[model samples]
Structures are given as C-alpha cells and as structure tokens.
Target: MALGTIFQHDTTDPLAVITAPSPNESPEEKAAREEREAEARGISDLIDEELRAERAVRKKEEGMVKILLLGQGESGKSTTLKNFRMRFARDKWIEERASWRAVILLNLVRSANTILHALSQEMDDEQFGLDDAFTFDDYYRRYRLRLSPLLQGVESNLKRLLGAQPEEIEPQKQTHPITLSPRTSPEFFVRSRTWRNFLQTTRGPEVSGCSLEQDLPDIIDSTEAIANCKDDIKTLWRNDIVQAMLAKRRIRLEDSASFFLDAIDRLSVRDYEPTDEDVLRARLRTLDIQEHELRVDDDADAPKWKIYDVGGSRTQRHAWLPYFDKVNAVIFLAPISCFDERLIEDSRVNRLEDSLILWRAICSSKLLSRTILILFLNKIDILEEKIRDGIMVNRFLPSYGHRPNETSEVVKYLRQKFKDTVRHCSPEPRTCHIYTTSVTDTKTTAVTLISVRDGVLRGYLKQADLF
Candidate 1:
C-alpha cells in the first residue's frame, strides 16, 4: 500500500487513472476470471445431459425372445435346429443390414454318448460321465472348451474336400489277391480243376498258376497278411457286384487295409457332407444360440426366429419345460403314417400304448399352457390304404378309453383329451391346433396343410396376455 501510494500520481481524467493501473493489479482482475469459469461449467453440464438422451434412444432399438423345444429322443430335434440355421444364414434381411456375429452352434446331443463318440476320436473324463442331471450351462461351458475344437476339425475337413484339386483324384489301389483256405470240400477241388482246365485251354499256359493256391503265397505272407486281405476282397467283390447290379459308376478300393481305413475315413468324411438332416440340425442349433445371445443382452436388436428344434430326450424334455413358458407358438410332430393295420390287432396292442404314452408326455408338459401347439402328422407319404380306412383308429380308441374308428372323430377326441390335460396342469388354457403334413416326391406335393380351427385356443391366450 505504501509503495502504491508513493507511485500514485493525481490525474485529471478518471479514464486515464483507470488505464494507468499496473498489469499486476489483483482483486478486480480475479472477479472477472470467476465469471468466465462459471460460464464454462454451464456448457459442460449441457453436454452430459445431451449424451444421456442419445443413449436412451439407442437402447430402445433392441428387443429379444426366448424359445424352448422338447420331445423324445430321435424326434428330429437336431434336424430342426440345422434347418433353422440354414434359413437364417440365407436370410436377406440379416445378411444385408445386420451386424452378424458368428453363430455359436452348441449341440446338447454331443453330451449324449452316441453323438459324442461319433464326433470325436476319444472322450475326455468329463464327457464319459455326463448325466441327465447336468444343466445346459454346464454343457455350454464344457462344449466351448473341448467340443469346439472337434467342430473346427470338421470345418477344416469340409474345406479341404471343397477345395480338392484334380490331382487329388488318384486311382484307387487294387485289392491284394486273397488266398482261400485249401478247399476242404471235394466239390471245391472239382470246380477249381474244371475252371483251371478251361482257363488253360482258352488263355494258354501263362494262366496256369493264377489260381488261389499259387497266387495267395505271393500276396499273403503272414497271419496279418491274411487278415488284411480279407477286407480287400470283401470290398472289391462288393463294389464289383454292386456296380454290375446297378450298371452305374463303381467305387474301387485299393486294397484290404485301405478298404478298412477308408471305412473309418468315411465316418469322418460324412460329417462334412451336408444332408437334409445336417442342414436341419444346424438351423435349429443356430436358432437356439441366437436366442441365448439376445437374452444375455436385453438391448440387442429384435431377433427373428428361423427354427425350433426341440430336444427329444426324456431328461432334456424336462429341462425344456420352462422354455415353453416363454414361447409364443409351438409345432407338434406326429407320425400318423407310423400306425399300421397290424397295430389294430390285440397282438400289436403295445404300438397303441406306446403312441398314447408319447402323446400324453407331450400334452402333459408345461408347454400346453404357454404356446400355440401345432401338430404335424408326419410320414404321411407312406400312409397305407388300410390306415386311411380308419379301422385301426377305431380299434385304438377303446384301449385309450375313447370311441373307435373315425379319423375325424379320433382327432377330435385326442384334441379334447389334450385340452383337459392342459386345463388341469396350467392355470389358463390356450388354443391347440392340428395339421396333417407329408413328404412327397414333387415340391408341389410337399407340406399340405389339412385344416385349422379358428380361435380354438386363441381367445384364451388373448384374454390372458401371457406374453
């Protein structure tokens, strides 16, 4: 203050005095800086509010659905999954617009011993001990670590086959000559002599030692040699006979060992060869995996379902019950054509019992309450005239405590029975429908829908708004 006062000089104009203040002047300059800081803080607060609004809009774009399939073993669960995957993979909407992540194809069937052995060369300790009590999560984790590699192997083999060059088609090795045990029967010696004499007469002396006795020693050297030669001759003979009968192209085996090896190789090679069944299973698995992915992230894009391949195992079917609680619809498979005229008789009564058990199992499940059940009468392609006559149908009804023999009548009876079962099990009853499906040679003949009942269970589901 003393220094300031000493430096101060009187000025006539107030403006001049104000301008004359040193650059180091303090309190007034500090007040001006505080005003600028408050304005910057206001701008930052506005930015954060706008960011949250944008995120809310993004979250609204995503939706998800979960579905479960349940059935008995070998009821075409895998086939259904594969078909669904194929359909989805080829979908234009998903392909052109969506950010398609990789498909996670998990096969619960792999947990089954039959399928696991088929897919892998050897089983690990965990695989050997899989049980019905095992949960889907356990299988999913183990499959990721262990079974995924086997799938990669399958993919690699398929790629190699697809990329094979012309040079890869080498001529098959010829089968080693097989040595027959010395003819213990006199008839064999007589036949051999006659054949040898005939060959010598027509082809000259060079063919003299070409019989089994002479050629076997040169071809087979030890017990191992004979064992190896066995399959070679069998394969060569089978191929030759088949080609002759079919009068078509032939597959020649190089030798016996090769034939055995080729058989083993075929097991692996066939996995890469896509069939109708394979395509179906892939589609189904893809659908399940996609659904699981969507559920994990609630903010994912709405997923369109491609297929529903339900598990057919008794244990797996139990696991699938909860999934039905979330399903909007259902597809039921019935092999009506599997019924035979023979099944009508008392001697074949077990067939009817078995059929009833299967139907009861399906209808008794929790699915009856949650989804629209569509029954597919499969194998109609092989339906016989006797079955269509409805005699067998009538015979079966009495055993199940229902009226006998009218096809329409039987269907109505079963439908009512299922309805009652569902009502007893679920708090609410829903619409159930039936359709007769068949496979035919022509595409035009495939997938004929016989009938649909209007609002049968539709009203019930609508009233409840289960979804």
Candidate 2:
C-alpha cells in the first residue's frame, strides 16, 4: 500500500528520481583531501622552523670547517661542483634547511691568462710603428719624445740659454755655411765686431786667436765661435737615445712582471698551454665558477659547520693544508677508473696521481693532525668490469712483495698502504673511509656502486662527530 501511494503521488515528478554519489565523490575522498592539506601545512611549518634553526646554528660556525679539493687541471673540478649543486637541489635535507651560502670558485689558470692578455693589449696599444725601417731623423725624433720627461730640466736650460742671447743669432746660411775645408774653424770669417767679440770670449787664451790679456768684449766674439760649434758637439750626445730606449724596455719588463706576479698571488698558478688567445679565454671563463659554503646541523644542541670547497688543481693542494687546521672531515674524491688500464692509457691516471699527491701532502701537513679523511670513489660505472672480473690490483706498492688480483684484495692492499703512508706523515694514523658514487648517466653511460668500505668512513665521521 505504501509503494502504491508513493507511485501515485510522484510518478512523473522530477523530485521522485533517486541518484547515488559517484565513486570519486565519496566521504573518503573528502577526508583524504583534508588530510593532505593538513600534512602540507605541517611540512611547511616544519621546514620554516628548521631553516631558521639552521641559520642560527651556522652563524656560530662561521669560519669553522674548511674542506678542500685538489687535482690536476681539467680533472673534472667544475663537473664535480655542478653535481654537488644538483645533489643539494634534490636532497630533502638541503632543500628543507636552506642553509647554503654563496659558492666561490676561482681558477688560477684563468687569472694568469687575464694578466697576460692585458699585457698583450698594452703592447698592441704602444705607438711603436709596425715597419722595422726608420730614418735617422725619425729615430732622433722618437728618442727626443721618449726622453722629454727625463731630460725636462736640461731641455729647459738649453731653451733659456738660446732665448737670453739675442746677439748670438745669425742668418741660417751663415750659421751653417757649406764648407769645402773639412777641418776649417767656424770663426774664420767672422767680420762683425760682435761676432769677433763672441769668438774671443768663447775661445779664451787657449784658442789660437785669443790672448791672455784679452778684454771682455774680445772674449765675447770667441763665445760666438764656440756657440757656432755647438751643433757638432750636440751630435755626439745621440748615444743618449740608447739610454732612452733602454728605459722604455725596462718599464715594459717591470710592468709586465708586476702584473703577472699580482695575478699569481691572487689566484695561484696552474699548468696550461701557452697560446696567447687560450690564456685570454681561460681567464675570461673564470668569472663563471662559483663558490659556496655548506653548513650542516647534525644535532639540535651541537655546533654547526662552515664548509669550504677547495676546488681541484695540484697547486690548490697547498691551499688545502690551511683549511685542514679547522676542518673536522676531509672529502677526498677519487675517480672510479683511476686504477683501470684504460684510464691509465687515456692519461687520466696522471690526474689521479696528482690527487693522491694532494692527499699525501695534506696528511703530512701539521694542520691535519686529527682530521678525518673520507674517500669518494666517483664515476663508478666504469669500475664495474674490474669489480666483476675480480681483476682489480694494487698498482702502488712500497715493498714490492705481493701482486693482488681480486678487487677486494686490491682494495685492502691500498687501504693498508695508504694507512702506512699517513702514519709516516703523522704521529697517529688518521682514520679514513671510502664510498662509491656516480654523478652522471646517459644511454652509453652505466654507473653502479660496486663496493664501499663504509665502515671505515662511518668510523671516522663518528669519531669527529660530523656524521
């Protein structure tokens, strides 16, 4: 009876139609949306607080920890920095903390190149004409122009002497008359009384025409005669031109040396080709390398970090020694294929050797008395063959006793050798750890972490309270 009444009341009414909620529009969906919004807000607050706390901690750790990277030129220092930046971008710990400061990357090679380029520019700007041939008059003119400043007083005196004695002037033809007699005296035909007086005054008693008791007026004529001979005497002083040229040369040499030395002092020196343009280009390119400080807060109550990146270059190794004094940990980067035959054939082993030298140098530095070393075996993709084939062997041996074949055995040998080497450098052997990493990948590139002596690294970091 109830069903019949309902059908009769709204058989054709639109309100009588019943619909159910779609699967996506249920209460569960709304609850999930609310939960996500709450979680997002919570994360945002957490991140903001963490960043604030990290900044506060870093403020106290400024200039505390300095880490350096050292290797040969073109040994992937720039690539490593880029990879590090990418890691920071992807890592939740770095992203949430927002504690990184600016990254400062300096290239010594580029700096030296810049100074050389500037010198070249200065050389090009000099007024010295391109043509090699020069007339005597042109040479004399250049000599005078260059020496004008140095002989400014002498020039002024000469000008004043010529200006004060108006009576000494004569017709140009008379003053420089063409003489047939090679040894004729310039005063022979001085008929004017003034000229005669000038000759006597200049020639004095020692001259043939002058007497010991000659009066002042008679001596004036001799002075005129001597003045007439002044041009011949002036020709003898042209040797000063050589002095002026030497002065210019000295100036150029001194300026170039000073410029180069200043550049070296600022950026340090690195090896490279000697092409003029290559030097310039390298210097101009250095402006793009950036430097950054990495700070990490391990515990809320612990001290912060002021991390430094030493960059990669053999010369930069010396720079690392100073940083070790203040650092708690050292991240030593080693190429995965550094020990591989192909890498050696490609001459990349030279770079690895340079890196090892840096490590050895640091171990010997007094500043690193207690610093921990963490070896990062980068570019592990190429190392897979050696690891799988069990063909890895120790290439560096001191006693020359045993040859290693298996990868693990080779690694152990290396560890022992490195440990012994460090012991020689320090009273106590500093702890070291190893890790495998691959920074790049492509269709042709396959990288994997074959093996890592993580215990050694963990132990060091733990001892230093840096993990």
Candidate 3:
C-alpha cells in the first residue's frame, strides 16, 4: 500500500486509535489489560456452564415418553391411569394400598346416605299422596333415623379430612323437568390435592400427636358404623319400594363407578382390604390435571414416563390446550354406555353427543394434529348391559338406523364415526388407533396398554429418526 493510503485509513477510522496499543505503552498497562481479559473469559465460561446444565435437564425430560389422557367426565381416564401405574409402578401401588381403605369407606357411607335421602324424599312428597303404596312408614323411618347420625358424623368430617365436598345436582332447563331433592345428592368429589396428601397422612399409625381415639374418627368409626348398618344397608338396597322409586326417577345407581352398594357384605368385614379390582373400580372424580410418573420398562434399562390425566368436564377443558403441543400421544375415551344418559353438568345435552363434539374439537386442534391419537371406545361392558336390557341404539342415535343393537355392531359404528372425524377434521393425515376397552377391567386393559406403549414409543422414535 502507498504511504498516503495508509495515513488516510488511520485518520478515517477513530476506533483503531483506541483499540490499538500505544507505541510507547508501559509494562504496567499491558499487565492490567491481560488481567481484565482473563476475568472476562472466566465470566463467559460460567455463563456457558449454566446454559449447558439447563439444556441437559431439559433434554432428559424430553427424552422420556409423555402421554396425556383426555376425555369427558366419568369416561375412565383415572382408571386407565391406575392401570398404567399398577402395571409399571407396582411398588407405589403396594405402598398406597392400605391408605385406600378410608376412601372405600367414605364411598360406602356416601351410598348409604343417598338411599336414606331418596326414601325420605318420597315420604315427604305431598304429591305422592299419603296413601301411596311406597309409603315411608314407621319401619323405614327407624332405618333413616338409625343411619342419620352415622352418616352425618362420618360424611362431613371424612370429606373435610380428604378435602372434598358433595356435588350439587342442578335441574337443567332443557331436559325433562324432574326435581332432584337436595337430600338425595351423594356424590362427593375431590376438589383439591389435600385429599391426595390425606393418603400419606392416613398411612402411619398416628397423625401428628393425636391419639387413635381422637384419631381420624371417620377412618376408625366408618367400618363399625357401616358394619352395624350392613344388614340395614342390604335391606334398604333390596327393598322393592325403594327400587321402584329409583327406577321411576330413571336413576341407575348400579351403573355408576361409586356404586359399591352391592359389595356391602364383603366390605363391611372388620379387616376389609380393598382388592386390586376394588381400587380400579372406585370412582372419585379428579377436578384438575394430575401428573403421574412411571418407568415403563424394568429399572435397569427403562425409560422415564410422564402421564397427565386431565378432568374432562366442559369447564376444565380450557386448561387442556397448553398441554397439546409436546405430547407423544393423547388417549381419548368416549363412554358408549352413556348413549342414553344425560350429562351431569347439563341435563339437556346427551352425554354421547357431548363426547362426539369434544372429539371433533380435539381432531381440529392444530396443536394436537401432530400428536398420536388413540381412541378407547370405553365402557363396552355397560353398553352391552344396556343392550341386553333392551336398549335400542337407534332410538337414542337416530342415525344408527336399524343396525343390529349387538355390542360388536355398536362398537363398530362408533369407531367409524370417530375415525371419520380424525380423517376429515384433522389438519393433516395422521394415524389413529382405535381400541374397544372396558378400562375398569384391569386384565383386559393390561394387554391394550402394552400394545399402546410399544406402538407409541416406536412411532415417536421413528419421527425423531432415532430408530
């Protein structure tokens, strides 16, 4: 370069003068500059280390399989989750088994109290006429009186202990106008995690410093009360008049998950232990999203798993969208047994129709379009029971159109309807596996779960090109 060009470049750029070392710099100035450079490097390395640690934790979580169970209320999402935990996380189940005793007792007391209220409603109804055959006479009055204290004492305290409350039954404007007496409402559902922690609280011999006398009275007294009333329970449940009253109101207590009325004899025993089947069948409505973790394979080589179970009620659905973005699979359960039943939240809407609408929304969700879709046409057992009792599918579902009312045919029809929804409504073509499941039946569900877990892992791995 020419001398004139070099001089011009040095004058034009002002930063060169500051960044360049002085021609006559002292040794002290050089040492200070080098020291500053070393400190900056140290700071930079610390930041890089923090970032690397955060990424490692995030990657580990992402590497594990994540499943979300989606469905409407009482569609067996909790039961399905229990199956996964029971099969893969047996140790946790075994540890928690004894704790479920209190829950089962609460369920029994709730059922008994419901029957008394129903009986009282008829007797108090002036419209039924004093001369009605199903009179709430002195004999029934004695049973009601006997059960009241036991029910009140255990029900309230127990519910408070477990952090749950009784659900209100409201009369809807659209459905048949039937007044549900407030006294007859017995469904107590968990509204908070306090009850979940109650399990741990009940596990040990004592709670805090309290003695067994001042102990969780509900836990101790429930069995004795229910046992003393066991004969009375059997009598009330088997009474023809009581049955007639419930039947006239179109209330089928037998069909609900919380209905353990039939097992009073076995359950009333002093040392009653809830069997595996009992735990799966116990119905306590989950109010919010519940997270469960399990190692799917044996500990030596198993991958971590995260399963999320969300409450399926209309109000709870708003919280579901955020979870749809990064899930491996979403198990959608539609209870076929509810074909003729109305939703508890809205009596005017048919439960089956609500499920179909929910399914359509899920299929159309852009966030879930890429997620694996697995449909469980759940509660086939109840569907078959209804059919055997002469319930015609076409009567409830007009479009069903005289197709044979057999369970296989009904399942096939519903399966196709869901399949078409995914095919047409989804943003893109995706694979959806449909399984006929009675999720309450743990044995049958075990097979379906294994097939689903393997299929989900393979599909997830294939998309990641890790297979």
In candidate 3, what are the lDDT values of residues 1-467, reduced to their tens digit?
76335444474467865565555668999788889879999999999999999999789877777899998988889889989999999977866666677667767776677677667666766446555634567578888877776555766656655665333222122354335632235346675476567655555554323232333455666677778888888888888877778767665453442357888888877777788887877767656789888888765554678999998888899999888878889999999888888877777888999999999998998888788999999999989889999989899899999899899999989999999999999999999999999987888899999999888988788867889
Better of 2 and 3 by lDDT: 3
Model 2 stretches with alpha carbons more than 4 Å out: 1-59, 62-65, 71-290, 295-304, 340-352, 385-406, 439-467
Cα-lDDT of candidate 2: 0.39
How many residue pairs in model 1 have overlapping backbones?
Answer: 27
Give the per-residue lDDT digits (tens) of candidate 2, residues 174-237. 5543321111111111122432233233333444355423332322332333233333323423
Superposed model 1: Cα runs more than 4 Å off = 1-62, 82-88, 91-303, 306-308, 338-368, 383-426, 439-467
Ranking by TM-score: 3, 1, 2
Q: Which stretches of candidate 3 lie over 4 Å from their true place?
A: 1-57, 126-134, 164-186, 205-217, 254-259, 299-302
Distance from true location, Cα of 276 in model 2, Å? 37
User: Order of all candidates by lDDT, from best down to worst?
Assistant: 3, 2, 1
Tens-digit lDDT string for candidate 1 (1-467): 55446437556667757645564858887677667767888888999889898887445422223334333433333433333333334342222111110010111111121122321222222333245125323533443344344333332222222232333222112274222111100000112233223323323234334332332222222222223333432343244322242221112111112223333222222122223322222211111211312121122443333234544433334445555554655555554533432221233444424444665665566545555665554444444434454446544345435454555555555556545654555436555555543422223212222122223223333634642
